[model samples]
Target chain A: MRLLIVEDEADLRVALTMSLEEDGYVIDSAEDGEEGLYKAMNWDYDVIILDIMMPKMDGWDVLAELRKEKNTPVLILTARGAIDDRVKGLDLGSDDFLVKPFDMAELSARLRALIRRAAGKTSTVLTYRGLQLDTAKKTVSVDAIAVQLTALEYALVQFLLMHQDTVVSRTDLYEHLFNEDDDSLSNVLDVHVCNARRKLGGTYIKTRRGLGYTIGD
Target chain B: MNKYRSIRWQLMAWQRFLLAAVLITLLSLHYHLRRKSEIAEVDASLQSALMSVMPAVAPMMGRGGPPPYEPNSNAPPPRYEPDEENNPLIIAETYLEEIESNGYYVTSWDTEKGLMLSVGAVPASASLGNYELIVETPHFLTLNGNRELVVTHNTDLIIVIGRPLTDVNLALKKTRYQLLLVGSLVFLIGHIGGGIIIRRTLQPIREISQTAEEIARGDHSRRIELAAAPEELASLAQTLNNSFNHLDSALEAQIRFSADASHELRTPIAVIMAQTQAALKRDRSTEEYKTILQACLRAGIRMRTMADSLLELTRISGNGSVLNMALTNLSEVISSAVEEATQLSENHPLSFQTLENSRPVQIDPERIHQVLMNLISNAVKHNPDGCTIRISQKETAEWAILEIADEGTGIPVDALPHIFERFYRVDESRSRESGGSGLGLSIVKSIIETHGGTIEAASIPGQGTTFTIQLPLNPASDR
Candidate 1:
């Protein structure tokens, strides 16, 4: 899973980025609404956390501009807890609303839900063959037994299963599993896939010679 | 049923009272004049009857006939004799008979012959007595049950004529009833008409109150409609509407201030909370722990600065007595503030051009110093390193003027007016890095206002900005 944080406060933005990144999700952040909008317009993140008050452009204008082209789930994070602001944020096509000083755990849970829903999955547990992924618990199981996989390997498997019948390319994996700051080598995807195959068994994953990789038939 | 306290009801009450008083006065005057004229008619008839009957009664007075005819005299006496052909008794009875059938009581009394003649049935109450003949004058007398009689006396004979006052009394009675009926009708009509007029006149006031009530109930947009209001009420409604506009704007400003304050405080709090929670989630090396602690510390310091600024702003704005005013020279305060700024920002050039005879103005010296420092620091902070911050003082007859002008990249003209508002910033992103809590200008404006002064900012986008302050020479300070 990947997220974008558009906050004006430097410390809060940094803290949010570090904390969410530590939760095994890729995080990209912008300092103001202009850059946030620019990045949001170009990228395909699972969820965007927007702040209302910003310089150059406000979150409202950013959201309005973004909604013209995309249906990315948006969680409005603002210091204004007034009902009018909340109603306005929701009315402007925001998926969720959270006031400032919100709990990290709650934010993480909300982001997970947004990501899951964006992929058209109802339940947290995604299963194919004998492998099961619980999105809420951030855990994977094989035949009701726990499987130990690194955060990157877990994200790769989850993304592949989410796209299920289709083949996901290497570029798609890089965009979904890593943020802009990551300098992933061209062969890094193969290394992660090889390690995951060794842990979860070889038949659970398959790779097309030129296309990319897929988790199920 | 009583609306005595309302202007409409009171106006009607007063108007109806005056109308009733005038009606009563007019009716009574009419009744008085009518009664006088009716009684005059009865008295005139009585007097004429007496005069016509006097000749016939003279022969019966036993004075013989008349004095012998005298020539060459002022007057001559004609002969009057008692003969059967022109019989005195018959003539006297004929005159008496005419009066008797006409509802007049007639009585003639002769003292010398002890002769008393009466015609018609007079009431016992109206019987003539000898004492009534002592004077030769006509007098009005009330006979049986208020019937009026005219009594006339001659040198030797007394004649009494009485008439029933039914015609006079009936006419006056009719006049009285008419007065009452007309007065009552007029009063009823006036009451209803006056009530309607008053209500119509006061209708605008009622509408004004209703609109004001709606505004009081949180419909601040509502206003009294004045298109059809009367001139006096139109002016009143206009004044009330102006006040409502002012109050509405004031409340809106307060709400914006609170929202901005919360936003400013919440950001730092969120930073502290997120950093602490992240650090507590896992064990980190000493260097990582130090980084997280430093981040929390910075956020804490920012919050403290904001809290102090907010408290200072509130103290100055919430009350006038918080100012400690004294007589101080504006130039002296400016000189010290400029000196401090020179040390604080050595790279930025600061200059103070003071007037030679800077007059003493009544002000809060400490607050004024704070204002100077805040403005000077703003100039130093917003401008480039080598920009010149010029501080100067001038005086008018009534005010001492202080101008703090900066020669640097100025503020945009659109944001100048709102710069003094609490938590307002020219550039939010730059303001954060500049370490401004955003309450500095608001506090300065409040302090100046408490000292009966005005502050204004004029900015030329590329040239620079100048903050001009006008302090009263001898302030009627609020404190």
Candidate 2:
């Protein structure tokens, strides 16, 4: 996928471009708003990563100018985490935004999501070892047979499917699936996995004791 | 009474010293002048008396008449005696003695009573015949007597007069008492006058000092009265009051500004974070995951826009002079804003119109673009899909006016005035759900105000709402 980064800070820009490039993205960079606007107007990009504070022109101007031309998906990067700035950018027709000093995983995920949204693919489905889940329909089908699953069981299956063959710790699963009031236990994740396994009629999920769980074909 | 009591001791001590010195000086001068005048009077009287008797005595001595009264050649020369009751020499002698007791002393030898004998130790040279005069002595005075006695037969009699020294001392003592009394009275008056003046002069200063103390104790409103005070002090008081006013106003503004800034920052951060957290708490199918991801993207976009607007507002607040400003066509700006807003709304029905002969306005294009985007997006966000958003632009001789009207649920009247305030939302819950950070109108107002334009909102409860922006066409356009 092709991406453009509009950032004034050289170090952050280099870091982001390298990271995104490593993630299989063809990265183009603009040092400031003028260049960003020019690049955005002339070239097609899967996503535009913009910073609010830049020289020549600012992120808002570039975003407004881009919106005037095309509906290119833009993800703003700003040091100011204030919501009003976010709202103003969105109100000006930006696709998404990420605050500075963010984890690379979150950025990548957001970038993926923005690309998916721009491509008009609202329903995202994932399949692993005959366990298939349709995200938009909120339904789970196991081996061409629909399986009734609770919210938690379904979330556990989905997490296992996304990180197939990679160990996900209990803390990671709990943080992603449960609210604060949920009494999370290592055994509770085990129970949910057991229930999902029983419903799938297979032993697809594997547990590395004292470490985490993984899904394998 | 209290006022007098305060300085009573001081007054008393000062008066005592002054009175003592004045009394001493007055007594000394009185004694000096009294002694001088008494001596002059005595001399004048003695001279006059001597002149009267000299003629009588001088003829007798010239005729050698005293030989007629020579009692005997011996027998102590008979101690020549005048008629016992009516002798002029005896009368003059008594008068001299009286004047001497009154501080004027006289000494004399009477010719009728003396056989060359002196009554007050009068000097013989001083009593030479027919040569009468006054003299000052340590203990007495002497004058020439009328009778003359001489071996030369031509001189007949000699008269003498004198005064004792004790009488001059007596008169000086009497004058000392009178001077002491007068000086005491003058000093008493001086002390009373000084006390009154000092008290009057210090009263205002004392009041001011007390008022200052009260103010230091946290009575911020304590103020000194300027009436009846000197001009310089009054001006100082006025300056202090002015400074207090400025301090109060600055403090109030700072408090209000901080509160508004914090409130504006809090709501959106809370919403984005809460929504993200909520979305993360679920596991979803492909579509559910996309929906959750989309929601996150929406929130992320919302937060970014808010940050951008906030940065813009802060930058404009710092220095508005750097904005790229130019003469812009209002109709074009409105049309573009509406078109972009329609796209953002996924092609919500939007209508646009322009008055005939519309004039262009001078503005910062980027900021005005922000303003129009914010306003139109706000209108579309609050309205249902396919609701008509009418945008119009017109130009008078003085101003270029642009307006956006929406048939959405209008803002509540109570919230109208506060709509332009940062993060002030009429419907907080609804705004959060609609992905609004509530800074749209604030940014719009900031942009419009930066361009020297005015924006106002008018809304009906159920009918519709309109926001109008008026920008000055030129510097002399009003003229």
Candidate 3:
């Protein structure tokens, strides 16, 4: 995946670049808003991780500019965990948001989700094995039996299914479904998985011991 | 000084009244004692006169000799022929005349001759040797010595004996006039002295009062003069100056706090905006575009949270007394928060454990919920992968305690004290990564205090950290 990182902090940019590069993503970095915007407009990237605070132009303006020319998926990385910024960014055509100091695994997962979403592949009408997800109807079917899911559960299952056959870490799951800075507790992911498993049957999603969860055919 | 002018009248009036009362009392006492002494002198003189005259007159009356002329009597004599030709009688008469002229009258009675030996021109029918004597005149003398004499005594005798009274009266009148003049002078002097003394005494007080008034009107620098004033007034002035110093310090602190808060908020907002604009300036691949967008979103969220927290902290600090408290089911509140936190963290596991005897606590549920959310969120954001976060509740005898513990990079001991301070971040790099506003913990502390609760944080470097919140159970009922 090709991704662009726009951050003013040199250390943070280096850390993020190193982390994303390890995940097989071709990384391009910009130190400030002007350079980041120049790079974003010139290149075709699967996802963009833009910081809100920079020298010349801000994240909001960047998002607006990117949206003007393309419907490409964009993810905003900010140091703030505020609601209005998220709404504003999303309103300006941001695909998702990740607060700073985020884990490497979560950043990878969000990139994957944004890529899949940009390709118009975020759907639930497909299935692996006896599990089926119908995005149009907002329902999940297993072995031809309709399975009901809460909105959050459906999103969780869709995320799992999109990255099927791959180990999706808890941090990645959190970033995809929620923003960065989410409270890290052992039961939060467990509870959601428990709910999803209960509706879709436990065997469809496999827990990988200490690493994360995987869906397989 | 114009500052002291306002209280000048009040100070002067009080002093004048006090001095006038004291002076009037002293002058009145002086006059009263003087009058009493003069009356005493008159009584003593009257008693002495009566004592001397009564004793002298009683002995004369006891002797049975011819009645002696009083020497101060005046009476008309009866018509007597050859009274002047009788040379022997004339000489006796002349002696009588000399005595009579000296204010006396003499008479002698001869029982054999059936004639009264009269001198000093006594009345003809008047007898000098009779026990029952009726002079039948305006001026009559009963000698009480067997004689009767009609003698007109000068009515001015008492006047002559009291002749020294003129000198006394003149002295008394002079004294009275002097007393009137002196009393009036003393009263006037006392009033003026009293007014001057009172004004002098209250001068400092007036200055201090006016200084206080100016200070109250927002002139915080106003100070009263303490030099050369009375001890008490000096101390009062010093105290006032000290209070103004404190006020000035407080105002300075408030100004500093606002400036710092604004500075902190503006930097992050500006950075986010600038970075995003930089990102948008380039053309990129789908992945690059996505990454740029993600960075923008993150910065946007950070700015928003900072702004929100700043607002919350300001609100909490502005007024602390008004708390919207209600009966809250703490367990339910915790459960709901846990559920929301879990949903937000797609795969991160969260655990919840509660004591079986947990009960509802009275608090502003929303505020307490925010506190729990902040603590739990912090734990989650700071921890390493595969680390477990524990959310648990326990009840003590007096409080309900909720704890959020995380196995993460713990806080340094040096940073612990300042963790709850506004805009304080431990490990700035990591804090920026975690997208912290630095106001979360501060807001949590403020909310807990408002609910009459306590919160404490303990951490071990590279091990873990736990945030404990203890809320007073039934706080409303206790009150």
Candidate number achieving the greatest TM-score relative to the actual structure:
1
Clashing pairs in 1: none
Stretches off by above 4 angstroms in model 2 are: A1-217, B1-254, B263-304, B317-329, B335-339, B345-349, B355-362, B395-398, B473-479
Please report how far candidate 1 places residue B476 from its true position, in Å. Answer: 7.6
lDDT of 3 by residue, B136-255 (tens): 232212232222222222221110112123444566677767766876787678767766776788878878888889888988777787799989888988988888888888787677
In candidate 2, position A96 carries an lDDT of: 81
lDDT of each: 0.79, 0.64, 0.65
* Evaluation by TM-score, superior candidate among 2 and 3: 3
Candidate 1 residues B163-236, lDDT tens each? 56766777788888888999999999998888888889888889999999999999999988888888989999
Q: Which ten residues in a row have the lowest lDDT in candidate 1 chain B?
A: B62-71
Candidate 2 structure quality by residue, lDDT tens digits, A125-216 = 76776878775455789788999987777767766666667888877776655533356676887888888878877777777888888887
The DockQ-derived docking category for candidate 2 is incorrect
- Best prediction by lDDT: 1
Which candidate leads in DockQ? 1
User: Model 3 reproduces what portion of true contacts?
Assistant: 0.00
Query: DockQ of every model listed?
Result: 0.72, 0.02, 0.02
DockQ, candidate 2, vs. native dimer: 0.02
